[model samples]
Structure formats: structure tokens, C-alpha cells
Target: MDVIKGLLVLACAWGFSAHSAVNMQQEAKNISDLSQSMTGSKEALNTNVISPLSGGGSLKTFDRKEDFSFSIGTCSASEVFLKILTQPQSSGRLRLLAIEQDTSLDGNLDKFINVNMDADMVCSNGIMQCTNVDDFSTCSSFKWSAASDRTVGLTRVGMSELGGCYCISGKCGNALAWRNLKQVLTDVAGGISASLAAVNPYYTMSGVTVEGTQATVTGGNAQCATGSVTDLVSTTDPKKLASYQNDPNKMKQDSQTETASSWAYQAIQSGSLNPQESSEIRRCSEVRQPIIDSAKLSDIITLDSGTGGVGYCGADCIMLTLGTVGDNYWNSPCGEFGAAARFFIKDYKRIKSAVLEKAIFDDWIQILLNGNYIWSGPYNNWTGQAIPGQCELSTSWNINPNVSFKHLFNKNGVAEFKMRVMVADAGEGYAFARLTADLSCKDTKTDTIANSCSVYQNDPECTLLEERVDGVLTFSSGAITGLNPLPQSKTISQDSCQITIQRPWFNKNRTYRCNVKTQSDLTKAIARSEKIKTSTTAKDYQDIQFKNGGIVGDSGTLNFDNLPTVQPCVQACKVRKPVYPDVALDGVDKGVVNPTHYDVTYKECSVGVCPLSSGEELVQACQCTNDFAEATAIMQIMRNAGQDMICSTGIEKPL
Candidate 1:
């Protein structure tokens, strides 16, 4: 009986080995099919499958017959296929532990998958045996043999438990679903790692004030400083008047005579005085008014040199002197001297001409208008001795149209009038002047159209439509009502039966007549009639219309059935032929013995041609006739396929 039991045990052992081999073969076939579907070739299953080993060389596996292996490079349906080999256990079951490195490449073995399998290396009951779908747990004790490379190893835990092993490195697992989930998680983790690595944490925030939906941001570098005020004053004091009598070294003595005045008057009359002479006159006049008065000159009186003393002149004239002291006597101190006085002409624009009549008890005098020498006295010479005489002179100046002097006036039409006096030997040192100007001005009229649309109908704003119809009908008076009025009369003739109708304007009479030889002719005329008319009253006629026939007047009523109506002519379709020497048929040659046609055809008749009116130009109606349907179809197909798959007509075949 012991011998019989031994035989039975041996038979059971052989049967069990055979069953495991079949299961292994089936699993290998499944992996091969999956790889074939994904890589499109059976040879790609084990191609380039490598993993780093502890000793520095790569361990290439994933072959159908390899023991304890997994595929890392290829994935399908977000899952990876792994085949693990194990020894038979006493309970006919296997417990497997898999650990994988973090997909983030942090050098940590954080992801793990624990699985249970049968002795035949098949998952338990053909179901997923992984405990966790996608869970990462700390494995601090796990360390790689070589830190430089991702090494994978499978070590047997004990002699009795042969299948109990650990896959010590880089992504390894036995559950297909868990492996696929790990692949997806790995991609997500990689993206997150990249995103986190790209972030910059050193940016600074500026001040922000939020009020309701508005936000005001005040940013960037700004600086502030204290404020102060500055005052500008004139360098020269007006109260201290300069004169040769007070300071002989600082001021020059004026030397004038009758010859100088005569020469100045002759130069002005001949228009030979250069700009230098004019500038000199202005300079001498400028010092006369130490502080020019901008006020308008009214009835001038005595001129005081800021000394609070009256002059020798009366209240109707202004007195000027060379020093700060006002002259009390006409025959003043005996010395070569001069005086100056200035006043502003505020209404200079209205001043057409000015005449100065001066009564002087002095040697010579000159007048300047805004720095230009306009007139001078006759006794302006400095060579002769003083002649004690009351010299009276009258001079006039006018604005010449040929020579514009308007620019001398400022924007406010203000001008300065300066008068300078010189005493050769100090016989008399005082002078006075009376200026009378002829003021003439006229009122100007300006007319303008505020809104042009009210006067011009062609203005864009007057038109109701944004865009105008280019070819539509318009009235002869340039009025466009966008309407097509019918003809004023109509005549119909058939088989010697004539009918005439006249349509006049509103409140006009309607006239119609029919000439026929027999009833047949009348019936033919009625049948041929295409239009119907209407009237507001029996006497007064209105517009013509097309409707069912009715009573015309007390004369009679003409009614007919099945009236023949005019039918518009059908438009002729346009045909377009493909242009020769086409790009699509670049290589085509008609002279070749055997030529291929690339389905070249004409385009549809209506593709590039519009329905033209009775008088439209042919060029305007049809613009494009070179586009072919077949070429267009070919180009569209090629574009959709993302490749130039069709050969041209003229391409030569290889011999």
C-alpha cells in the first residue's frame, strides 16, 4: 500500500506542473498580443527593454520565457503588463510585495503594491490582486545598491518560501490596473514637479487699495523732496538816474547841432537810413524812459523825475530833464544835455496815422515808435553852438500798406512812443509835445454754414442708408428715391387686333381702345392682354396696376379668363474651363505616347458668374473662369489628408 501511495503522489506532481505550464503559456500569449497591438509589430515586444543592475550593466528582460520581469517603457490603456515567476507554496498560494521609486525622481522609494497570486503565477482567481490601486507609503529602510543608476532586483526571502521576494527598484508591480494607475500618476506627478520647480517666490507686492469694484495700485520706486519759493528782482534801481552832470565818467555827453537834425530829416525823407541808424535812435530813446509807463497817454502834464517837483511846462505838456531835478526855468544850467519821455499807445491797432506838433525850448528832438525811428526834428545837429530860439516842428507818420509795420504792435496792440531831446550848449533843456493820431477802424463780417446737411441733399448725413446702391435708378435732378417707375404707355397687337392704353399722372383721364375685325380678334386681344388697370373714379384715373379684370366705366365691362401672362426669359448659364499650364498638372505632356489624366474637369456653370441684368457689362458680371472643380477637389482632399499624395500630370514614371 505504501508503494501505491508513492505512485499517486508522483502522478499528482506531474499533473500540477503541466497545468502551471499551460497557464504560463496563456499569460505570455496575452502579453504578446497586447504588445503587438500597441507597437504594431511582434518583434517590438522585447526591443530596447533594459533596466540598470547593481553591477553597472543593464539587465534586459520582458521576454516570454524570462523569470520575474516587468515592462516599464511601453503602456496601453494606461496599464502596464508584468509577468512574475514564483515557487509552489504549501497552501498553493503566493504573496508578493512590490516597491517602486517615486515618479517625481526624488530618490525615494515611496510607491508600493502588495499582491497575492496562485502557484501558477496567475493572479488570484483571475482578478486584480493588488491591495491598493494607487497608494504611496514610506519605505525609509529600502535603499538601492547603486545610487547612480536605477537598479532592479528580485531576492528570495527564505529557502522554504521561494516566491516571497521583493522587486527592490524603479517602477515594478504585478497588478495590471495598479500599474496603469501608477503610470498616469507618474505623468501627473512629473507635471506637478515641473510646475513647482518653475515657480518664483521672491516677487514683492506693492500697496493695493480696494473700493467696491475698483482697485488702485501704487507701485515702483518714487521719490519726494521739500518745496521752496524764489523771487526775481531787477538789477538796476530806477530811482537812481544817470546823467553826465552827476557822474561825468560813467555817462557820455550828448553833442548835437542843427546839421545833425538836418541830416536825420534828409535821411528819413530819402529812405536811405540803414538799420544801424534806426537802432541807435531806439537806444538813445530807451534810456530816456528809465521805467516806461504802460498806461495810455491822455492830456499829458508836467513830467517829474520821481523827485516830487513840478516842471517849467504847464499842465497840458510833459516836462523832461537830464537829471533827477525838474527844470524850473526854460534857460536852465549851461551844459550839453538831453531828456527822454515815453508812453504806451494801447489802442495802436485803431491808430491809422499820427502827427506830432511840438513847441520846444531846446536844441533838437527825435521820435521813435516801438524802437523804430519814425520822425526827427530839424535841429538835431550837435556841431553848432546853442541857438536860443523857440523852434516849433510838426512831423507825421502813417502805416504803409506796401511796407507792413503792424508787426511792431504786440498781441494786445500795444506800442511804445518815445521822444528824445538834446541840448548842444544848454541854452534850453526842456521840451514838450502834443501827439494827435487819426484813428479809423471798420467792422468785419464773416458768414459760415453751420450744418451743411440742411442745404445739400448729397451729404452723407442726409442719406438714410449707410451705403448707397451704385447701379439703381435715379431721377434726372439727382434725387434718388430707390424706385423704378413703369413706362407711361402700353400697346398690344396680335392678328391685326390692336389695343392701346395710356397711363397719365394722378387726376388724369384713362383712355383705352380696341380695334378688331371679328369676335375672334377681340377674344385673341383679351387673351393676349397681360396687365390690368384701376381708377379712383369713373372720370378721374389713377395709377395702372395688375389685377383681375373689372368694369371700366358706364360704357361696358371687359372680363376674361385664362389671360396669357408674360414669363421672364431664363438666364443662360455660364461655363468655365480650366486654365492650361495648370499648377496641378505641372508635369503633364500632351506629346507623350501615353498620358494620364488627373480627373481635370471644368467648373460648375454658376460658380464664378452672376445673373446679369439687361444692360450690365459682361466683364462686371463674370470675374473668374479659371477655377476647375476637379483641381479644387484634389487640393481639398490633399489638404485634409495632410500630404501631397497625388502625382502631377507631367511626372515621368521610372523605367
Candidate 2:
């Protein structure tokens, strides 16, 4: 937008065509209007102070006697030159008076003449008058501002000129004694016109590309010969791009991703506790000693063989199902336990060849077969195939309820035998084994079994029993009834009859742990954590531009080298239709009344003087603007792609 005003004249001419008589007529009208505007120049001049006139008002003086002086008629000098270019010294009533070289002076052409003036004029609101003489009012108001070297231009130009003389019409108002301002204006204009004529096609038609288009001067006063305009384009320098190496947003994303991944990996490698384990610990803490903690027993009971048949096992092998009402018992009788199994395989041949090995037995409670303790069940081989071959092991044992279960302690808590029931040659088999227990106990405090069982223990009717497995005394059975009946029975199905054991297990280490490997939900948690840990690696998105060899600042400054070169983008211009439709010549209307096709190359530069004759200000300005735009676009893309690097501290709030 800033470069538009300077090229208006060139643009209009370049867009014209000779057959466009209507446009030419409008251009002529435009020149007429410009001339009419300048016609008031004489009336616009400031005339309160006497301007030394040479006969017909010529500024040139020929003799020393002809050197003039005047008095500012009625107004103060300050009002005449309201904008003082220098510090006020109150030197004299004369607003401006000086001596300068006079070519016509005697002896030498360098001889000088003196011009003086006094504040005796009344000049206000575009009218000037001497003390008693007639008023001098011919030109419009003269406006100026103090610029470099204390020089000023007229009207709007006066507000912006740094140091120069410019004339649009041939004259520059009245030439005062300060300098030959009028001549300077004329010479500058002449030089500009001559220079433009040689290179600016807008003033010449020698290389005209369009048949109907006509090139004209700025005021549109005259048309030039056919000619070509200069070709120029805009470009950005990459080295000037700003740096973003230390942006906080990018760093935060990177940090989050890294930390999350590490935590996820750790969670996967190690295991975590389940809520049920904590509940068991809390419940056991309140109960009395001598209690068989079923919760502790469960923790140590891991699968040794079989899937979904009898014991605890992996899902792919055997999954254990606790029995209803009593299997997941927190506290159970020390020596009484039960087991049932569900085989996963339905193959007739596989089930027939399947073998059921010893799965679970009490460590303290002993089962006697002919006075020998039985710590495990003998191998039972099946011969018939059946789906989910459910089986239960029933073992009856003698009880000494007078003894508290706390006396029966194994370091690992679990009193179970490993079971591996599988078909000999078949890879598929149901080997899962599960256990259940009736955690019922009766206090003998009121009817002490100790006093009554003492007599029976010494009798020959009750036989003491024991068993040895792997050199460990795993089971022992004893009878404590004075008569042929056991102590009053306690059933586990009645909750009110059960005792609450509240002691935590001594060995907290799990026989089998569950984690991300066992649960799909935990796997997703790990993925989310990893996302956070990897976010920061792409912190400095600006660095990506460097891969393309673009020069950007490694520091906070800018680099302009290696900037991309955008080709001159073309656009559709007004289609010049023929005045009268006719036959075609080269696929176009070429009748006498039809216009010829015109093709002229032009550039819509973003900055700088088009035709690029001089200064680099436009070039630099355009480069800076374009580079910043590109950087912004790239950053937005990153944000949209979910690579936002903005640092966050608390939970993200909803918009």
C-alpha cells in the first residue's frame, strides 16, 4: 500500500491502449483539471511584505541601485513567517534580509547585492497590504514547514520534503532573495522530465506492446511513443528471520513427553497391588492370633499346572475360580480344605488320557489312611472325555478343635500341592485347579476340649498320625473326643459363627503380580505417559526451516540469507473486447474495427520503487514484512498439529 501513490501515473499509462479513445478523453479531462488547480498559484502567494520587483516583477536585478528594500506594511514579522526555521534572536524588525552574489554587479560577477526589509506589512488570511498602499492579493495561501537546512516546500510537499526542490508545473511561486528558488525548481523539473523520457515507457511509446493502449505523462497532457516499462519483483531475505530457540511452550511439551514415557515404562516393568490385598490386610489386623488367614493363603497360591481346572494359573493356561460362599474365605479352619476343577478342553481322547495330580492339602490338618498321614492325593487318571470335567476332592479328617490354628504356621502361609493334569501327547488340556475352605471354629473356653480331650488322647482308641513329604512334616492328625464323637461342629456358611482374623501376612512378596501386561487399560495408560515424554523433542519448530537451507537467526536476531524467491505472480487483467465483433485472425478478432491483442509484462511489487531505479529501502521493508508473515504461518501450523509447546502448570481448564 505504501508504494502505491508513487506509481499511480505509471500504472495508468501502462494500462492504456490506443483504440481506447474514451479513456484518452478522460485522461485529457484529468490534465485540464490539474491545470485549473495550478491557475490559482499567483493568488495563493503571500504578498504582505514588499517583494523587490524589477520593472515587470522579475526577480533578477541588474544594477546596485535597483537592489530593493521594503517594509512589512501593517503586521508583525512573526505573523508573516509564523514557522521560524531558526532560534528567535529578535535581530531586527526585518523578518528576512540578506546579501547574496549578483551576476550583474560591477567589477566581478561574484559581487554581492544587499536586500533589506522591515516589519510594516499587514498579511493575514491570504491578503497582504502595505502601510497605505493598495493590497497585494493574487495567490493562494503559502504553507511551509522548517525542514533540513532551514529550507521548505510549498503545500503538502512542504510537510514531507527532507531536502529538495520539486515542481509539478514549471514554476515554484515567487523567487525570493534567500535563493533563486524559482530557477532551482525549473532546473530540477527539466532534469527529471529528460531522465524519465529516456527510460520510463510511461512517457514514451517506442516499445508499445498493446495496439489500443496509449502511454501518457503524469498530468495526462500528452501521449508518448510506444515503449516498454521496466521489469522488477519483490523478494525476502531469509537471514533476517527472527529466532525462537528458547520458547517456553516448546520446552514444556518436550519435558512432559520424556517424563511420562519413563514413568510408563517403570509401571510396566514392575507390578502393582490390587485393592483386595489391602482389604485383607486391614481385616486381619483386628483378629486374635491362631487364625488361618485365607487371604494370605490365596496370595501364595499360584498355578503350577492346568488351565481353569483346579489351581490358580495364567489365562492362556488355567484361570482359577474361587468357590461360592467359602473359597475366597479370609479365615478358614487350619486343616480342613476342599477343591474342585474345571477342564477347558472338550476333546474326547485328550480328556480320557488326562491325569489329575495332587493339587492342595492342609499343612497342619492330616488325613489318615490306615494310620499314615496323607499330605497329597494319589494320581487319578481319567479314561472318558467330557466338557468341563468337574470334579471335587472329599477328604474326611479327625479334629482337635481345642488347638488354636495359630500354632500351625508355615513361612509362606500356603499349604498346597502343585497339580499338573494334562493329556500326554495333546498340547491342549484343562489343568486349572481351585480350592475352598470352611473357615469355621468353635471356642472351647466354656466346655474346654483340653480337660475332656486329655482322657481320650491317652486312650488306645484314638491313633496319632503324621506324614513326611520332601523331608518336611507337612500334616498331622489327632482325635480329641472323650467319646466316639468329635467336638461340637462349626459350619462356615453361617457368617455369625465365623471369627474375624485381622493379622497382615508376613511375606508381602506376591507369588504372581498383575500389571500392564495383564490388563489392556494399563497399556493405554503407558501410551499416554509416553506421549508427554516425547512432546518436548520438537520444541523449536523454527529449526525445521533450517533443514531447507533457509537462513534464520540462531540467536534472537534475524538472518536474511537463503530466503525463498517467490516468482512474479500473474493475475487476470480487464479483457479488452473488440468494439465490433468480426472474423478471427490467429483465433482473435482482427477486423479493422476490432482491437488487437496486447501482451505486456508487468510486476506488482510489494515494496520499493517499481522499475527499480534506486535505493534499497523498499527492498528491505518488503523482506522484513514477508519473513515475519511466513514465520507466523508456520507457528500456527504447529499449533494445529497438536505439537503445541505452551507450558502449562495446573489441570487444563475447559474453554
- Positional deviation of residue 523's Cα in model 1 after best superposition, in angstroms: 58
Q: Give the least accurate 10-residue stretch of model 2, judged by summed lDDT.
A: 79-88
Q: lDDT of all the models against the reference?
A: 0.30, 0.26
For residue 225, give model 2's deviation from the true position in Å: 66
Error of 1 at 203 (Å): 94
Off by over 4 Å in 1: 1-332, 343-350, 362-446, 452-655
Candidate 2, residues 594-649, lDDT tens digits: the string is 36443332222322323222221222221212346867988888776553444375
Q: Which stretches of candidate 2 lie over 4 Å from their true place?
A: 21-432, 435-655
- Candidate 1 lDDT over 1-655, as tens digits, reads 4334433433333344433655655675677555443343333322423332222234444443444423331111111111122222333223333323332232233444343332112210121122332222222111112122322233222111221112211233333223222222222222222222222110111233333212222221111001111111111321122223356544332233333545555777675355323211100000110111122223222332321222333322322222233332333333334444433444444433233433334445454545675444454342234433444322221211122234454333324444455443333333233333322112122212233223223333222211111111122223433222111223334332344333221111111121212222344223222111222222222222224664332222222222233224322334333233444556756576644232222221132345333333343233334347857998887686644443566564332
